[model samples]
Structure formats: C-alpha cells, structure tokens
Target: MLQLTDVAKSYPTPQGPLFVLDGIDLRLAPGESLALMGESGSGKSTLLHLAAGLDTPDRGEIVLGARALSSLDEAGRADLRRQRLGLVFQQFHLVPSLSVLDNLTLQARLADREDRDWTHHLIERLGLAGLEGRYPEQLSGGQQQRLAIGRALAPRPELLLADEPTGNLDEGAADQVLDLLRALIGESDCALLMVTHSARVAAPLDRCVHLHHGRLADRTP
Candidate 1:
C-alpha cells in the first residue's frame, strides 16, 4: 500500500549538507506491520514524516496507494493526509480544551466522514468509557495516550503511522497501550508503520528494519 523508491532527504549543516536518508527503498503491503528501529539522529522520524506527506523528499518519491506524493501540491498533499493517513505521536498531541469525545472525533469530522457508532466503539475499545466529557489535561498519561490512539483510528485510515506510541508511559502502562494498539490494528486490518527503539516493542511487528547512518543497517529476524 506504500512504497518508497530511491528516497533521500538532506539538510544544510554548518559544515556541509547532512544526509538524513539515502537511497531508501521500502514497500509495505496492506495490513502489514513494520517496526522502524534506529538510534538518535538516524532519520527514522524524518522517513515517517516523508511517508505522511508532512515533509517532501529532496530526491525520489513516496507513493501511497499508487499516488506519488512528490507530484501533489501542498494543498493536495494536505488533503491526502487528512483523508488517508492517521498519525500517533509520542507526545499524545490531544487538544487541551476539547473533551475526550470531541478530540476523538475531530479529525473524522474534518474529513467529513464521522461515524457516531465507530466513535463510540473506539471509546469503548480504547477503555475510555465515562470520560467523554473530560478534557485531556484531566486524564492520566496512559489515558491520554489511549485517547490519542482512538483519535487516530476514529477515521478508519488505511495507513497508521505511529512514532513511539508507548514511549511516555510506565512499563505496565506501556504494555497495556501496546496491547490495545495491536489488538485495534488487527481489528481494523490497517497497515501499521511504527518507529521504536525497544526490541520488546519491535518484536510483535511482522518485520523490523534497523536504520543507521541514513541507510538500512539490518533487517532483523
């Protein structure tokens, strides 16, 4: 459902141009799970941003469901992102003023595809019951993270991009969040691309690809 061919990104540095990714070639099938493992400064997040259309590559192309991202203008790319992509971040970027239910439904509403039943189901599945009226600040870190997951899945996106979804939680909370995410992803049958450093976190994925020095270092067993 997603493909990257000869994808490369670079930035101007004080010394010279610094390459963040070079000759990246990746393909993800529908409903597949991939874990992107790398050290700091290894460009995992940069690659994710490119895949999500939040950033454009300086070379090559990113194809999502046969649509080449480089060919789309900014507005078109933004629309594509709104319609086809779901993003989960490490910070749980929930709106501070909105209630949990509103936050969950925000993106779907924006995309003009809000489903009340699905929203309710997501609330229940994410263990967010009876907290619909509460603001994000009122919830615990784990609850907020769960809400973030719900918000991402509320639109039933074909591709879900998660960056360290469980990074901020305690071990028990992290396990709970990861289990919930995995179960929900299975239930929805969406392709999942996650960036995480922990082997325990990456172990559950279908494949793990390690990135180093702007290139694929190893495809682990």
Candidate 2:
C-alpha cells in the first residue's frame, strides 16, 4: 500500500545541507506491519514523515497505492492524507478542550465522513466508552493515548503511520497501548509503518528495518 523509491531529504545547516534520509527504497503491502528502528539522528522519523506525506522529500518519490505523493500539490496531499492516512504520534496530540468522544471523531468530521456508529464502536473497542466525556487533561497517559488511537482509527484509513507511539507511556501502559494498536490494525486490515527505538516495541511487527547515517541498513534485531 505504501512505497518509497530513492527517497532523499536534506536540510540546510550552518555548515551546509545535511542529509537526513538518502535513497530509501521500501514497500509495505496491504495489512502488513513494519517497524523502523534507529538511534538519534538516524533519520527514522524523517522517513516516517516522508512516507506519511507530512513532509516531502527533496528528491525521489513516495507512492501510496497508485498515487505518487510528489505528483500532488499541497492541497491534494492534504486531501489524500485525510482520506487514506491515519497518524499517531509519540506525544498524544489530543485537543485539550475537547472531550474524548469529540477528539475521536474530529478527523472523521473534518473529512465530512463521520459515521456515528463507527465512531461509537471505536470508542468502545478502545476502552473509552464510559470515559468519553472526560477531557484529555483529566485522563491518564494510557487513556489519552488510547483516545488518540481511537481518533486515528475512526476514519478507517487505508494506511497507518505511527511515530514513537509508545514513547511517552510507562512500561505497563506502553504494552497495553501497543497491543491494542496491533489488534486494531489487524482487525481493520490497515497497513502500518511505525518508527521506534525500542526493540521490545518493534519485535512484534512483521518486519523490522534499521537506519544508520540516513541510509537503510541491511540489519534487523
């Protein structure tokens, strides 16, 4: 469902242009789960951003299904993201003012595709049914993260891009959230590509790839 070919990205630094990702070639099939592993400055997250279309590559191409991201303008990319991509972050980016229920349905509403039954099912499956009226600040870290996951899945996206999704939670909470994420993704048949530094977190994924010095390494753990 997702493919990247010769993808490269660079940013201007005081010294010169610093390469963050170089010639990345990867493909994710429908309903497959992949984990990206790397240390600080290894460009794992950069690859994720490029794949998600949150940021464009300086060169090369990112293709989702048959549509090439480089071929689309900003507005078109935004439209594609809303309809086809579901994103989860290390930090739960929940709207503090909105209740759990509202946050879960926000993306679906934005896309004008809100299905009350679908949203309700997501909330219940994510264990947020009784807590829907609670705000982000009032929920525990795990609850908030679950709410974020519910929000991402509410849209029934074709691809899910998660960046350090368990980074902010404690061990127990992280495990719970990751398990739920895996199960939900499986049940929905959505492709997943996640960036993580923890081996424990990446272990359950179908495949794991490591990045070093902006290039994909032929290594896995």
Candidate 3:
C-alpha cells in the first residue's frame, strides 16, 4: 500500500547539488514484498527514508495507502508512522533498560492500540517466550534482532520498512532471521519493503529491483 511517483531527491555538495534519486517510481501493494538493491551511494536508504516519511524528498510524492506524505506536517507524519508503519534497521534500536516485553509493546502502547493477544503471539512466534523479562544486552545478536522485529510487528502495521535488517548477523543467522521475518509478514498480511545490498538477501523477496544512477531498474533476480 505504498507508492512513489516521479520521486527525486538531492543534497547540496561542495561541487553542486548531488541527486541521489531521479524520477524513481515504485509501488508495494498490501501483502506484497519488495527488495530494494543497490551499491553504496545508490540511494537505497534515501528512497526508504522518503517512503517512511523520515525525510522529505526534494521533489515528487510518496503515498502510503490513501495518504500523501508530502501533504503531512512532521507531526502528522509521525502519527502516520506510529499508526500505520513499522520500521526495522541494521542496528537493533531497542531500549536498553526496557524489558523484552516492554520493548515489544512500546509502539503499540504508544499508538494506544496494544493487543495483549497479539503481543503474546508475537513473543511466542518470535521465539522469545522465555525471555520476556530480559533486556536487550542479555540477548544474543539473533535474539535481539528477533526482539526488534517483534517490537515492530506488535502494532500490526500495514507496512514494514526494513533497512539492512540482517546485516549484523552471520550468514546462517541472517537467513534464519529473514525466514522468520517473511513468515511473520505473511501471517499478518503486511507489505514489506526491505533495503539490502546482497542479492542472496533479496532473493527470497517477491520482487527485486536495482537502484542505479538514481533510478529503479527492475531485474528478475
């Protein structure tokens, strides 16, 4: 339920304005998954930020469902993010002091939509049943990442935006995390837009698109 049309983003440099995304067009429907692939400096994160409304694009529009992000003020965007969007990143952004259960329910509680059943389901499904009282530092890397993913999903968001979600883990752990992620997304019928550089990481997604020269180039692999 996300769409980007004629999107272009640039930043000022000593030389001149450096465009990172030029006329980028992409769409992710509900229950669909997309992998955004690119080399460093290809603007994959920029595009993800635009879609998440974390940063505004210099031009073009990003629409989440029926809402146009360009029309929203910062507060509105934050509200939208809280209610409709779930975000995961390479670095697990867990609160160090909060218990695993608290972290998982934080966003949902903030949105005033915490569902205990769903939260408990997330805990069990994420393989975090016995570790509810533990803090982020107490868990292993994979466990921490799973907790992060669970936290993001606790709110039952319409869309999940992940940037290098498995980057910190070993290959085996990364694959395991990806499998769990896709399974959870499927069970919830949530759309996924994951930004990653590895083709292997992108391989399990429904579609993969490469970002080249500030544009999206569709590729089967």
Clashing pairs in 1: none
Q: Each model's TM-score?
A: 0.98, 0.96, 0.98
Q: Please say which candidate is ahead in lDDT: 2 or 3.
A: 3
lDDT of each: 0.92, 0.90, 0.94
Whose lDDT is greatest here? 3
User: For candidate 1, lDDT tens digit of each residue in 41-77?
Assistant: 7999999999999998989989999899988999999
Higher-ranked by TM-score: 1 or 3: 3
Clash count in backbone of candidate 2: 0
Model 3 Cα shift for residue 148 (angstroms): 0.6
Q: Which residue runs of candidate 2 sit more than 4 Å off their true CA positions?
A: none
User: Model 1 residue 109 lDDT?
Assistant: 88
**Model 1 residue 118 distance off true place after TM-score fit, in angstroms:** 1.2
Ranking by lDDT: 3, 1, 2
Better candidate by TM-score, 2 or 3: 3
